[model samples]
Target: MKRMRGLLVLTILCFLISSVTSLQAWEILQQSGFSQALGDIFFIDEQKGWATGYQGVIIHTQDGGKTWSQQKVELPCDSELYNIYFADDKHGWVTGSYVMGDGFILNTSNGGETWKIFKTKDMEMPYSISFIDNKKGWVCGFGNGTILHTEDGGKTWDVLYKPEKNYLWRQIFFENAQKGWVIGCESPQKGKFFDTIMATKDGGKTWQVKYYKPVADEDWWYPWSSIWFVNEQEGWATICKKEATLLYTKDGGETWTKHQFNLGSWLYSVKFINQKEGFISGNLADSGKGALFHTKDGGISWELTAEFSKSLRKIHFLNSQEGWVTRSNGYFYHTINGGKDWECQLEPKTHLHDICFVDRNNGWAFGKYERGGGLILHSEDGGRNWDKQRLELPSGDWQMGIHFMDSQHGWTGVSILGPNSTGAFLQTKDGSKNWSITEIEYLPQDIHFSDAQNGLMIAEIEGGPLVMSFVQTNDGGESWQVRNKVARDKELGGRRIPSRIQCLNAQQWWVMSSWCLSYTSNNGKNWTQKKVPDTSGFYFLDDQIGWFGSNRLYHTKNGCQDYKEQELPMPIEWISDIYFKDSQEGWCLGNRYYVGDSLERCIIFHTTNGGETWEVDLKSPQHLHRFGYASGRLWAVGDNSVVYGIATQAVSALGKQYITLGKVKTVLFQNYPNPFNPETWIPYQIAQDSDVTITIHNIKGETIRTLQPGRQRAGAYILKKQAVYWDGKDDKGEEVASGVYFYTLRTSDFSTSRKMVIFK
Candidate 1:
């Protein structure tokens, strides 16, 4: 029996270990490769391929379009790889720009197991390559049809020919060693619809331009993007149509005819599987919205197949049935049934700001700035086009907030805290005009003015007993009033307090402090206090509902009457901020320190059922962080200025459980164990800290208590200051307050809460 039991226990342990291992896999919906700005893709088979892009990025796939992995390459950081050519599954070569030099090529012999670099003698960059076998190949770039021939599997190269000054050849192909053709743009810069095609009758010893059509005046600058040959007699070249035109030739380069493939964007690439079926891809203007056009009758007519929001930088085909297209965004799209269908492969992001999409059509992206500054950009279209815009700050001051009700009526808040610090309130009534800077009667930190008239400002003051106040205005920043006064030294043996005010309506407002949640119904007058959970992150949805998150959750219902604890998934020991769109959606954020003792991750949790159950959104588990919601998006900013945002509507059902996202509220609770003890407990709440003060006083109205004499953030506070621990004595150390005493909590918005206590 003992032996049997031992075997059963061992089997159980194995099963448990297997179960735990399976659960450890982190599964996301999808993942892409690092965004190296992909430039080319080549397939050896339908299921196996190689891709190349910027910064020497090479990705290989073995299972068709299902999975891909990065291939290692040793190239200088300054190199920009342009084209990849694979002879087999393991043997391949890539041509790219050099490290502070001209063009160089790299080749692998043992199925991409290793690579060798071959520097070519050319100032013009090598952009195109064709191989007859492992030992014979041709490349062209940066010249009027200058071709290089490589022997001994690309170990050495010899220049074949350098064409004239104004001609730029891009593609070269040969039929046997005796006949070949080269295609590129011609000179004179006008009326050149047909590209210059040269014929070499003697293995490329010499070349003659057999056919040249002058480029039209409208299409003078851009090159003839690509060319393909089925054999010696049949060929096709993709030419940018000053009109919607795709051209084909039947009898070598002697004659050309326009193939009808109408498109709004320019076609840059063309490939024919046979005579009847072919595919083409290119950009729509400069935007990434390129499309694949397929023709059934030898380029006679075409139809759109696949469209992309990223630029179709290059395309490669293993056969008529399978091909791949790469984009500038470092993504590879592969199609098995020709260009009829496509699947994408993602790339890693080299910089924090690599992809910028405005709508979907217009966007701008750059690889890297050599001078160590911002290299990425913005756009106006839906990510289809891009233009480089200078990164300049608006003239007047750094814009703190941008509020546009429509397009014309907009408001911005600016701070004059620079070296030219002036208390100026700048306004722009027109969409474009000189900004109106006015000095107001307030040294405020935050401003939330409604319309052009009614406004609320929070100010912190220092002096005597009172420390903070809220001043308001109703006449377009002309006059101000001391709506409320938040004084220190009134409650809990005269503990100092800090407070902040967030106006929900005009009359209903919320104040945040280190200790409690304080609510006001009539402007900032009469306040009520309710204790919060801990001393950190809290969010309010409105005047009645809010969420407090620290290690746990403390929720309030019915205005601010009560506080209750709610369970969370894990212990969020560093919650920093909370936001809610309504009563059902909310988010809480903080950081968790990793095992490396660094804040390598962010801890973001969302709740759907009003803080009942929480789901982890981000888990950096790193340093300190803060999050807030403006408009319909929640923005989280962190240590390195790492910003993250997600739409409020995109939140999952689990995310909606958090009802507190944006609004701020405050509450303060009375001290516990008022009767007698060496230690007592005092707690308070604040949504935000303008300035907060808590103080205790005797019946004679003499000040004896002070707590938190400065500003504080939203969350609960526990006061255990030894000074507030009276030896059952009054401010004079004598036993007092056996009847009743008073305490007050004050905020920077000039909102205060008072509580009465009795001593034994």
Candidate 2:
């Protein structure tokens, strides 16, 4: 009897460990590589610095700008941080505007380990910040020339100066407590504006105009993008216009001299290490390349030292040999040898517009870099990692559509925009190792392949009566033939243009334009038009069953002979893409719009019983453009270089349980007794039997521990005895330091991650 009892206990323990190890959830294959544009950068020394940008992002670097780690700031969504100032290592402040137009300041006392927010209700969007010490600072920006001052370390702020009614201060600089200068633009009337500079003598108590320049406002220039002072006697300001302009002051802003360079660039930030050396950062207006210039003779003559794909925003230099520059797309560079050479310290920034997969293990994502030029990313092993493929194209070109018939045959459309602008078809055999370009007469909007040799494309014609044309390739894209034309619709005020195209076989094709849906039964020779509410999304499961999406869902069962409106579980403003695996399972990509917000919230809706009903499957903060299904999984690609995958089989198996179990959804609950010392418990629930694992990561995204609890049956593990426990030790049984850490619960089909704090 004793041996039997011991055997039973061992059996239970083995089952417990194995049961906790299995589950499934949607997994992020590629992270959103820095979605927001960086606005400002500041370094207290050569070894420590901070940078701020949109979406309340604050990243800190300890070894200059070689590598950086994110610091969490609890702000509302869409908050824009514009400027950062550090009085020392432990005291710093960041200024920006909230989503509702109120300005805010983030103050940190423990070197950005924590932050306190102070909202300035009276200010309407602060842009620049200047500090002389830890307690005294000034912020200036949009509020009818309003300037704010803080003497008690951002706990309270008082309005210091308000200039004319239409003056928009851009930057503020202070040489000391009693003397300072502010530069901005002023518009006494609509459509006419000029640059203005003001000087203060009594710590912003009294001000006088030092210089003003009136222009015709032909191209609308923001006169002063940035301003810096080496001393009270010498200063410089950069201008944003068609040509790069630098303004130099020798007598404390009393008079200024203008120097112009024909670089066709917009200068943003200027910094000087001494009286005779300076650096300026900006972007070329034509190609969007980040530009850096160095001058040893102050502002007289400059040499182009470096150029990159993204636009450069801010520059911070601790001395002549060490400095950092930030890009508009959340990338910063470090230079140890002045401006001669620099190294990037972040992932490359690109926007993935369309994705295609020949099988489960082979795929390609097509888009453009944030700076310019075409980008193609290939992934093997189901998108766990991605590598870039080289396609020789101009900086002004971008890819639009991609289609693959197999692992070795593919074609992509390229839109060329420059002198003699047109489009071309890029065809590749042997798995994208080499591509040959075929020039076409119009821009290719969308392309679809029915087989290896038969393909259909919708092309847009410029400066012609024919708005769009249908092109066909019969011999594997070696040559193309124009088969039909879509004239501009006079009923819609000549605005109808083809946006998407679908091919079912060699004989049937469909096209969705802005105003109508057109289909042809005999390979694009003749077309029949059908009117729908809108043409945001369109999909055809076969020749018989089809769906169209606008603000509402419309379905057809017999090849568009008639339509019926379907109901959605939630409200969506617009549907961007639609896909159906069969007559019963489908998914739609859409957005929900709020009344006052400028951004659209993206959501994915899934249906198990066709168009009769749908349920919310996923929601994303980043914009998701397109998706595809392959190898029993759904893959999506979108803005910020993000790629996501989810197993469809997991959702199908949980369908019946969702009805019986009151719609139980997979959830990863917050850890108990957060900020605890040396111990914590993580609780979660799975909708189906799945492989489960929990990973702990530090603020720098380095994994510290991974707990595998085996395969778990469908149920809640929310009780303390049932939850996964951690002993606050790393993989090597060493104690972790006190800081912020992230814990992610991943299943075979679903995944959710959240942050936890360790205080001891």
Candidate 3:
């Protein structure tokens, strides 16, 4: 189960990063106009604004918040994004942290169209970012008490202060480049806790404690959750102690006035358009009530503007009249009347997670609609507008895994609900305009297609933990059966899911969990295990050679049977994912610890001459995730819900012809594990849409089984450590004997033959 957590975290990181990755100047594509939960909202002007949330989510609206378009951010999609700040509609920055002890402060100069990452030096997750102008900003968070200052529009940042104690700085507001107020909390001992507000005059080079307040009655837990400052002299902070408390500061933090709320309310977000007006919202978790407070007279007193049952977490205002508050229920309340009245907006029916542009005008985004059916949003006008295309899922499911073989062929792995629920595998052949779904017993975390007939899928088995079933389909989704049950330990527990699966063709494969790697030479029919401390990312050139990433990169020969470790140019905590175009060229992405804080920094390295030498590709440590080789491009997906691709030929000339083919041709490769151990993989590809078929024949020419008989475009291999092999079984699921056999691939215009020997 711990192995499952690897991909589980990857999936979450994928989603978390999805929302923000696309923000590189946002182009939002929602599901029936609904996206996932929104975390923070910011307005650049009365008409231009941005909102961010789960999955690296950032939405931009140019039309006074009436319609929002999602943007594609080009950062690793694994960070927990929190706040949005735009110096202008063209220049903006967003801040967040990663689960892996790292944080992000991304900047955009061209209306969110492109971004440059100003990575935090310390591993502390930045919670709040404030830019006084286009060139000066401040960011602060907990973990060694980080408070960062930037002078050149985030081109570089200077650590003003990182406290010795492990205090969590939540929010930082800079009235000017030099005058700033930072708010956070700390715990010195078990029961002793206090909240603090600080002031910095030397551009964060020096910080002084301005005010400290203790939560009375031994609670020691009065921490401010949100902070806002209209100017240096006027600021407000919301508290989450025993009850929701609103704290106001005037005269440049010389004094503060506390206004207590109902004992059950926990006010979170505080936003003020000006010194005279502001609003706050929070959830009364104790009573299942949602509360909103409004103050027109600069926080001297407050009025209950609205109430609901859901807990509110964040609030934003575009002027005092045009404001929105996000809640725990994945919905938001809007007020055009200065909080005198409010209107609620439900969650969108379709919430997209990923978007890929084949070209400027052709692209596809994925998400789920309200009914829980996976959907594709296709754009033909350079992402200016999108049209939703609903998928016909097998059991009315939503997408958990999605991949496109091309603009035409794609797959979506979906999860079904209810007692009669089974997993769903969805396919799109018409460029995402339509879909066909198949019901399966497993829920795939990742899917791959070596070709149409032979492929693999790694999935979490239904019903239990650490109990994953591996399956293969020789007939391409017609039927699936267990190839192996990877029960690492019967006594093991938790959510350890498979993080990565690398196949060096069909004969050998590698599956990496969080802490271990399983290798198979017989197409996943048998396996060998090596326990690794942080085996999160890996890549294999063949059965005999591979690299596993942890604090350091390790190399294994003789098919991972044994390995030796190598010291990288710098230390890494764990690799998120790894990729290789060939044996000689590859890329490694992983995290390294920030100097003193447990917070982490992401690192990227590329090797051109196998593992003999390496060089850093990234300027410095920044959060990055899974990578791939597609269309002569090295593609990387990260925090920005954005997919970044670099020309493959530029970095590695060998990758110019990465896929070995003289020209465009359709050929069937020989079955993997050809000598066979009861099962082997047969892979074939098609250049165009065609009726494809695969048939197995005995030594005497008698038909054993027809693996495939259908029209095909392209297919997915097991993105994990599984594959579709014959398994020496007949059409009726009967086991066959040992012998040499032939497999024929037949299409409307092409035919090929391969031989395999199956031993039973």
After superposition, the stretches of candidate 1 with alpha carbons farther than 4 Å from their true spots are 1-32, 99-101, 164-166, 186-194, 263-265, 283-289, 328-330, 347-760
My TM-score estimates for the predictions, one after another, are 0.45, 0.73, 0.49
Rank the models by lDDT, top first. Answer: 2, 3, 1
Shift of residue 49 alpha carbon in model 1, Å: 1.0
Query: Which candidate achieves the best TM-score against the true structure?
Result: 2
**Each prediction's number of clashing residue pairs:** 103, 27, 67
Better of 1 and 2 by TM-score: 2
Name the weakest run of 10 consecutive residues (lDDT summed) in model 1: 8-17
Give the alpha-carbon lDDT of every model: 0.55, 0.74, 0.63
Query: Residue 752's C-alpha lDDT in candidate 2?
Result: 73
What lDDT score is found at residue 39 in candidate 3?
A: 75
Tens digits of per-residue lDDT for model 3 on 1-760? 1111111101111111122232222122222443345777777666787777764667787876666788887654445578788887788888875543456788888888776776786745677888878998888875567777778888888887877665657787887777888777764423444678788777788778877876564333335477778887888887675556777777777777876555346677788878778777776546757787777887777777777756777777777678777767456667787776777543344444444555544666655554344555565544445565555443343325455655687665665545654676766677765566666767665565555655667676777536555666666555666787665443212223344556567667777766677777787778777776566578887767788865468887776667887655544445667777777777787654232212224545778877677765652223445564544445444432333445545573222222221322565654666445566776554555787778888868899898764676532222112223566789889887655577887878888776665433
Q: How well does model 2 score by local distance difference test? A: 0.74
Ranking by TM-score: 2, 3, 1
Better lDDT candidate (2, 3): 2
